[model samples]
Target: MKKIILSISFIFTFVICFAAIVADLTGTWKGLIKFGDQKLELTYKLKAEGEKLTGSIVSSYGEIPLTDGKIAGSDFSYKIDIGGGPQESKGKFMGDSIQITSTFGGNSVTNTFKRVAEK
Candidate 1:
C-alpha cells in the first residue's frame, strides 16, 4: 500500500505546516482604526498555543480582553465586548502584518496591523 503510505505522509506534513502558521501568530501588533474623521490607535498583544489564541487589545479607551479566540492556519477570530456588547472580529495573518475586520451596528471597520518589535 505505497499509495496509502504516501497519502498519510502528505496529510501529516500539511498538518504540521498549518500548525506552524498558527503558532507564528504570537506577538504584538499595532494598528489604527478610523471612526468617521477620528482615528484611534490600538495595540494587540497576542499569544498562541496550539489552536487557541489569547490576547488583549489596548486602545485609548482601555484594554479589552479577547474572548472566544481561535486560530486556524493563518486566519483567526475573536470576540470583544467594549461596553457595547460583544463584537466578533475576524482576521488573516499576512507576513509582517494582519488585517482584521469587525462589524458593529451594521458598520464594518477594518484595521491593518503591523508587527511590533520587542524592545
Candidate 2:
C-alpha cells in the first residue's frame, strides 16, 4: 500500500510540472520583427487547447490569421496566411522571451520577443 501511494505521488508531481510548462506560454505577447532596415511591430494573441494552439497576428501592415499551430515540449510551430501568401515560422519559447526564425521573400530573419506586463 505504501509503495503504491509513493508511485502515485511521483506521477502526480510529473503531471503538474508538464502542465505548468505548457501553460506558461498561453497569453498575449507583443514584440517587433526587424529585417534589414525595415521593422514591423507585431502582436500575437495565443490560445492553447491541449497541445494545439490557435492565434492571430496583428501588425502595422495588417492582421494575419494563424492556423494549425502546435506546441511540442518547448518548441512551437505555426503557419500564417497573409494577403494570399503563406508563411511559416518555428521557434522555442523561453521563460520571458521567444526566439523565432523564418524566411520571407527568400530572406531569413530572426526575431526575439520579450514578455511585457499586462496593464
lDDT, each prediction: 0.92, 0.80
Can you write out model 1's per-residue Cα lDDT over 1-119, one digit (the tens) per residue?
99999999999999998877876789999989999999999999999888899999998888999999998889999999978888999999997999999999998888899999889
Model number with the top TM-score? 1
lDDT computed for candidate 1: 0.92
Candidate 2, which ten residues in sequence have the lowest lDDT sum? 110-119
Candidate 2 structure lDDT: 0.80
lDDT of 1 at 74: 92
Q: Can you tell me which runs of candidate 1 are displaced by over 4 Å? A: none
Tens digits of lDDT, candidate 2, 62-114: 87778779888778888887655778888787988877787777877788877
Q: What is the Cα-based lDDT of residue 29 in candidate 1?
A: 95
TM-scores for all candidates? 0.91, 0.84
Counting only residues 3 or more apart in sequence or on different chains, how many pairs clash (N, Cα, C under 3 Å) in candidate 2? 0
